[model samples]
Every structure is written in structure tokens, then in C-alpha cells.
Target: MSERVADSTIKGFLYQFNKTILEIVNADDEDVITVEGVVEDVDVLSASGELEAIQCKYHETKEKFIPSLIFKPLLQMAEAYDRNPSARIKYTIFIYVPNEDHCQKDIDPSILNSALATTDQSLSKIVSRISGKFDKVEFLKNTRIVFGPSLDEIECSTKAALELLGIQGSDVDTLLYPNSIEKIAKLSSIKDETERQITKAKLYTYLSSATHTAISKWTLALRNRSEILKNIKQQLSSYFSQNSRDRYFYIDKNEIDDYEEKVVVFFGNYIKKYYSKPSHVTAPTFIINDNIEAIRDLEFRLYTKGIKANTGLVGNSFVVDHFFRDPMKKINRNHIEEREFDLRLLAMDSEQEAINHRKGDDLYLVCSNTPNNIELTDVNFYQVGISSFNELEYVIGIRNSHE
Candidate 1:
């Protein structure tokens, strides 16, 4: 027969076999339902009083086979069984092959056919292979089936076995139990940790870039103090005292100093908010090198013009502020000094060491002790300037030098 014809014949025989089994088992009034268009060659439902669900299968092909159609129904039955413990509905699967020789040559017919035989030698073998092997419940050992027959004889043989067993079907379990909340909780915890790490990484990148930009802008503004003072004055006018009798004016230096202090405070707050804890040190190792070198070059330029720039170690590293100061120029000197008074960078071997120092001081920069002088507070310190020793040959001037 053609493959299609063989499949159709096998399906018809399976349906007849299913009907016989249902009749022998005395299935429920609505339990002998037929499901069409299923991929399986034959599917049987027996919801009789004693039996929960039974599936029948017949293979016409010579190829070795195991029926996969029963897997879903078996799972459904197991779930139903779990819900109604008192429901004494048993599951059975029957597979009928042509004969012993036919079964040996093709599929391991013993796997599904064990239930029908008088002696359970074949069933015991299949059970041994399954017991303690899978995490889920094992297939029912109560299954049985008769060996093969031609299309005409298969249904009769199946009916004979069903009558001999005195099978009776009842209501099969229908409810599918939900998964436990503990499993979902574990998965959710894993997802939460992943998201937290992602957020921290993103925040770190944002804060690092913002700090770099702020430093760049501050350096540029310090270079052109007069223009920055003009801008600050213009911006601050709206906030100034507007009384006609009391005319309030801001000094250029004071305005510039206030702007610089604001920038410092902004950097401090940004670091506190996003980078409160020292994360993995992925930033460049030699960040201070270029800035230190630039300071040295500026000192050299001043030295070439016969100007002596006094440089001293404030906290640990040599100060570069002296080289940038112009004696004839004066803007916001008091405010600038006040903002720098407490701000000092301590040289450290690694970022971890720097973090450790900051942690000891509650993540704040500390200043070197100056004898007989009040310590500066409410300021910020940033590490800047070139980092090379070769650039140190250009030492020139110093700012706020009372000594």
C-alpha cells in the first residue's frame, strides 16, 4: 500500500480498537469522544469508572518507532492525578505490533506492549530502564497490549484484552496545576541582579564623562577669567537686589569666584550621587600624567620669561597653581582661595589606594596641615596637570603664598 493508504488503514484500525476498549471498559457517557486531525496514528480516551485515561497505538510502517503523541496526554493525566489524590483513575498505554519477529526487526515493541502480556518480563525490562532515571513521574506500569494482527484482526484482539482485564473508565483529571511561586521567585532574583549590575555600569560611564567635561570647562574658564567674570555678572543680575534706594553691585572677582565655586560644588554633588562607591577601576591608569605635564610646560614658559614660579607640595604632589597665576591680574582672589583652601589631592599608587584614603575620610579629599592657619572648608579638589617627571623642569610661580 502507498504510505498515505497505510497511514489511513492504521488510523482506522486504531479508532476501531479504541472503540472496543471503550466498550469493554464501560467508559463514561461523554468519555468516548473522538479527536480528529491529530498527528498520532491512533489516540484512545477511556474515562470509565476505574480507569482515568488509556491511549492505543498501531504502527503499519516497518520502521522502528516509539509513539510521541501520548507524551502530552500523559502529562495532562499526571497533573490531574496530582490535584485529586482520592481519584483512583489509572493510566494505561497499549501498542500492538505484527508479531515478536516483526517487533524485533522494527521498533522495540516491548516498551509499549508490555502491559497486555500475561507475563511481564518485557514490561519489567522497560520499567528497570525508566525507574529512578527521570526527575518527573515514570510512565504507568499498568499498561498492556496484545501482539500484532492484520488491519481486520487488530481491533478484535485489543477488545479481547480489554474484556479480560475488566477495565472500566471514569472521569479523567482535567485541571492543570500551576507552577510553584518559589521557582518564579528564584528566576526573578536572578533577573533583578542582572538589571542592577547593568544600571551601575551605565551610571558609572555617565558620571565619568560628566566629570571629565566639567573639569575641561573649569580649566578653560580659569584661563579666561575676565570673560568668565563678564558672563557671570550678566547671569547674576536678575538675582541681584532690585531696590531703587539700595544699589547692589557684584565685583568681577567675586562673581568669577562664585561661578568657580558653583562648578566645584556641581562636580562634588555629581560624584556623590552617581559614584558614591568606588566600582571596578576600568578608568585609565595614567589620567593625571598629561595634566601634570601640561603644568610643567606652563612653569617652563614662565621660567623662560625670568619669572620664578614657587611650587610646593600642598598635600603630597607639587602644586601647579603658582605657574598659572599672573601677579598683575586679580579676579575673585578671595573666593578662589577659599574654594581651594581645603581642596588637595594626595598622590596614591593606584585607584584602590585613592579610594581607601577617601573612604577613611568619608570619601572626601583632605588638605595638608598648615601651622597657625585656619583650615579651608567647603571646597573641592581635583587632580589635574601633566604626570611626567620631564615636565617638572618648568617650575615658575605660586598663588596665595604668605610664606
Candidate 2:
């Protein structure tokens, strides 16, 4: 039973995420949303300097609204009000109501007073925390209960909200949900409260201007390789470009057979597509994600194929200039991520070279089923999961007819 996933965490994350999106879309230009706010799960600061503090909850198992479920949250809000009595704060509970038949006035002033003012031993400590600090009447008057849709229903509502903001054609799943959720998760992770907040304008810009770039390392780990690959193909196929982008290939030498052979095939095809038969396409840089030995082995393999890759620890003096007629698509002498080889004498500083020749236009993290930790060189990139050498060829559109 424990192993069976109910996806409760995912539901909660998407619910909060959808709510944040809706809030940003509906908010005035000056209103800003503070993710994982001090007062509640979300806080909306308005142009008039008022705060709309919201606590969001998604409980699919619960049959209906229950005052006791909100015991701790209400107490926390009451305490917040007590601490800053002068602040204009409006408390709201954004919760998934089990059904419409649930109690209508579930959180009226009288109901809140009855629930919070209780002397029940179980809730005595909770009541004690905010006891006599905030005016019960004032708190109740400002507080309200908002029933939300079921977990399944939230997506449609969120999509409707997104549609209002001009998103169309693409699946909302690939574009906004993870992107916005990723943004919120990043913002909330910051300890500085002010820094964690985003204005509606800035957030709208982020959501609209940026394309799908969900290379979340853990999310990648969680998904089945096929599902992730499916999503990757779907997303990347829509905006496929091989120019000015860096292709990062991450292969755990332990996961596959004849890894070097397959990698060479990947390289050959990559070169064939972009550089060998040029049709206005700029040759994208390649970064082999491996330890020194593996990279050295790849260098040796490519060497046999008469392809000189700048990857190394393979004993050989190197140069930055394309003097030896090195393949244009081969790794640069000063590529930042790979480990330095002993004989591959690089005259340039790797980090500065990386910065100077930024692969910021396009990027990728193509990896095997279990590659090393894939750190995105840039925030925007596509991830392709390759199971076999054949699949690697297929993903890069180099699957030979004979194979």
C-alpha cells in the first residue's frame, strides 16, 4: 500500500502552482505574489498596500469541509494578525471541497469563532497560541473560505486561466505547469523573503516569454525513461534547431555495451547533419558527459575514425585554432565541463572560454538511462533519454537505414 503512489504530493504541488498562475493572471499590474509566504502558502500584495494571504490545501480523501482541518492554519493566521494588528490583511483558505453538497457556510464568523474559541483539550494548545491576541470579530470579518475544484478539475480551470492569457496550440502540460512550478519552487527555496516574491508583470513575462525548459534533475529521475523521452521528443520536435546550441551527451559508461562505438555513431551523425553537409546550419558544440578516462577513450575511438575531438586526458598537445583541420563539431579545446587531460595542453582558461563563447542560444542534456548528475549549463535546454545506441541515433535523426 505504501509503494502504491496516490500522487498526493504532485497534486498539492500542481494545485498550489495553478493557484499561483491564476492569481498572477488576475492580479493588477502592481500586485506581486510571494511564494511560500510568511503568513500562508501564498501572499498577494496589492497596489493599495493590502495583503491577500492564502492557504491552499488539496485533500481528495476528505468528504467535505471541516473546521477542525483548518485548526492550525486559522490559529497561525490569527497569530499573524496579532503580531501586526495595523496591517491590512485578508485571510483566505483555498481548499478542495469534496463536493458541492458540503456545508454552505462552512467558515462563517460564528463557525470560526466556535471552532477557534473552543476549550477542547486537543486544541487547547492551538487556541492558547493566539488566545486573546487578535480580535475574534475582526479576524472572522476579514477571513473567508473558498471551495476549490477537485484535483482533476483544477487543470481545466488552470488551462482556462492560461487561455485567457493567450497560450494555445501546445499541450499545457509541456509548457506552463512544470515551468511555472519550477519557477515557484526555485523562488520559494530562497531564504530571503523579499527576493522570493515576483511581480505579476515579471512573472507574466517569465511564463509567456520562456519556452518549455523543464530539465529538473529530480523530475527527470522520477519519470520513467520512456515517458520522459516521449515528452522530450514532443517538446523538442516542435522547436528543433541544431545551430548555436550546445549538445551535451551524458552516458554512464557502466549502463551500456560498446558505449564508445555508439557515442562515435552519435558524433558522426551529429557532424553529418550540421557540418559535413552544410545548409545554412551552424555547427553546434558537443560536450561528452563522462569522466576523464571515458572521454579519453572516446577521443581515441574518434581518432581511429579520423575525427579529432578536443575531449581528453589522452596524451596529446592541443591547440585552440582549427589549424589541424579538426572537425567543426568536435569538442572545443577549452570546453568547460569535461575534465582536463594530461597531454591535452589547453592554453585558454576553461571557465572564461566557456563564458566568452557562451552556448546560451540553445542547449541539451542527452543522457543514458543512468548517466552522471546532469547539470544544465543553461536554464533553457531539452533533455533526451537514450536507452540504446540505436535510440541515440534515432533521437538525433541519424538512424541509418541499414541499422
Candidate 3:
């Protein structure tokens, strides 16, 4: 990884450790609140006002047990201790030494002790080389060396930390959920220790409510509303300034931070509203693969509950009673003639049943069975007529003729 990416990853791990493991374990201590962007990678303030500063070091390969490798952190610790003698601070050097293969293994404490005792270029030699500012005692009394955790440990701890923060059940799934990615990206900003804690607390509050709502809204759009999904994809493509010809766009976590606020707005003002519970009507029942019995039961329930039935079928409905229910209609006046004609044919079996089923409402049926042409006809009670059917053969013929 690049230095910037590596540092960012380390910083993320430290933040997780502070929030998830440290905070939860010290919940009652109150005094042991963590401070970030301060003297150390992880700083904890105790009840007596003393500070525990932990510095984390990461290496792609096992860190060499030598004075040059360990002297810088020791020097930083000496500086911090000198400035905070009254605060009685202790410094910890946490080293994450991964192998060349990128797998972490524990380091032997003796290796660190031996490095300090090296004769020619030892810790003492390094300290002497640094203008005699700090001695071996300062390094020994004020600082302790420790090893960092494995990659697996981080993942397990992350899961535990999220749970400790009350992100349980479905919210747990939201951790990897796509819509929640933008919210996570919004937290990428660097801030002082206090503001960081407060911001995360506020985020937790939002996740508790927004995660479920976002998930539900996404599910509704994917399952029932193709047009909504298409619009969302279009919006994303436009936002990213990608090829308009692209039919679908994948969301990346890195890019999410940039447009997260816009996503929040889209979800709040548009997507949620589109999928919100219908006040005047209930949810539409979609009969998958033309399940007759399911449609019959749904129609019966709608009749018994006196709920306006909003139903869509993918295939043919052989039963005439299915037609009697309210038909999906184009409400504009321009469609009124076509709408009336459809109502007439649907109610042809029994005008009284159709009238009774419609219950004095103008309802039209939306079907995929396109006849060659629709014939306008007048009939008793409701207009009923049948016309010849053709495939794209007639449409192609017309297009060719015009050409």
C-alpha cells in the first residue's frame, strides 16, 4: 500500500479500538475517556488526571529489532513525559509486525530488551546520538513496548465494537449495506478528540433510525418498482459524470463520502416518499408467474376488507371476476376514450358484476395483450368488443411502409 493508504488504515484501526474496545471496557470509568490527534495513537485520561499514551506502529514485514527501528517512538515518549511530568503519563509503543507474507505473529519481548542492550549502536547509543536529551532511565520508566494485533483480530473486534455501540440485529447487516456506505464515508473527516466522539455518537443515533428505513426503501424499489431503480442509477451516473450510455453503476465506499449528503437528501425527500405507505390505498399486489389461486385469495381479501385493490398481473387472467375489480387507468382526459373502451371489454361477461365490482369508480385494466388495433364500440351498460391480434409483425410493417 502507499504510505498515505497505510497510515489511513492504521488510523482507522486506532479509531475502532478506541471506540469499540476501549470505550466499552471503560464504560463506568468515565475518567478513562480517549483523546485522539494528541500525544499518541491512543490516549486515555484517567480519573486522577494521568494520561496513558499508546503509539501504534505498523510494518508490512516484521520490524527489525534494532535501535534505529525503536528510537523515534522512545524519543517522542520522552518529549511527552517531559512536558507532562505533573500529569504522570505513561507511554506504550504498540508494534504491528506482519511477515513479508502480510500475516501477523507475536514478537518476543526479549528481542526488544536485547535491542536496548546492543553495545555498538544500542538504545543508549541512539539516545547519546540525539544530543543527550533523554537517558536510558527515561526510556525505561516512562515507556513500555508492546506488539499490535493481527488482521483477524481487527475484524473480530470491529464486529464486537459495533455491537457494543448498540448496532445489533438488522443494523449489523447495515454495516456492509450499500446505502449505509455513504453514511460511513461522511465520517472520514479528521477532527479533534472531543468532536470525533460527539460526531460518532450522533452517527449512532442516525444509524438506529435511518438504516432500517433505507433498507426497506431499497428493498421496495428493487422488488416492486423498476422505474425507481432506473432513476436512481441515472442519478448516480450523472453524479459521477460517467458515460450516460452505461445502464448500471456500482457504488464504491470511497466515492460515497463525496456524495453522501446528496444521497441522504435523495433518500429523505424522494425515495422514501415514493415508497411511503399509501394513505388512500394499500400496497399493490403483484401476482408473480400468474398465480391464479393467490390472485383469487387477494381479490377476496380486498373485497372483504373493502380495500381498493391495486393488482398487476404478468400473464393472462382467465377468470372474468378478475376483470371486474378496479382496473389500472390512465387518469388524464386524453386517455379517457381508450380507458372507457378497456372497461367495456373487461365488464362484457356481466355488466352488473363489473359495475358492482367497480363500485361507481372509473377503473381500467392495464394488460400486455396488445391487439392489432383497438375498435371504439358502444354497448349496453359497458362497451364490449374483441379485435384481431398480431405480433410485432404489423408494427414492423408500418415502420417499413413509412420508411
Q: Using TM-score as the measure, which candidate wins?
A: 2
lDDT of 3 by residue, 67-160 (tens): 4465566655655655555557777776655542323333344544455455644346443444334344544666676655654454455455
Candidate lDDT (C-alpha), each: 0.29, 0.59, 0.38
lDDT of 2 at 8: 67
1 or 2, greater by TM-score: 2
Q: Model 2, range 1-403, lDDT digits (tens) per residue? A: 3522446666676678778777877888889899889899899999999999998878777776677777767777777887887889999888885764422233567566776777778666766767565687777778777777775576667667666766555455555555565677667667899998897678667777655545453233332334544555555654345443433343434444456556677666656554443232343445543444555665677778755565422245323343112233324443322221211211222212432233335445444232223334554555443345665555455553213
Off by over 4 Å in 1: 1-14, 17-22, 25-49, 63-73, 79-86, 100-150, 155-403
**In model 3, how large is the Cα lDDT of residue 99?**
42
**Lowest lDDT 10-mer window, candidate 2?**
339-348
- Over 111-230, each residue of candidate 1 has an lDDT whose tens digit, in order, gives 233332214464344334443333232334322333344444543443343334322331111000001111111222342333311121232233233321111112222223233223
TM-score each candidate.
0.23, 0.62, 0.40
lDDT at residue 60 of model 3 (Cα atoms): 36
RMSD of each: 28.8, 8.5, 21.7
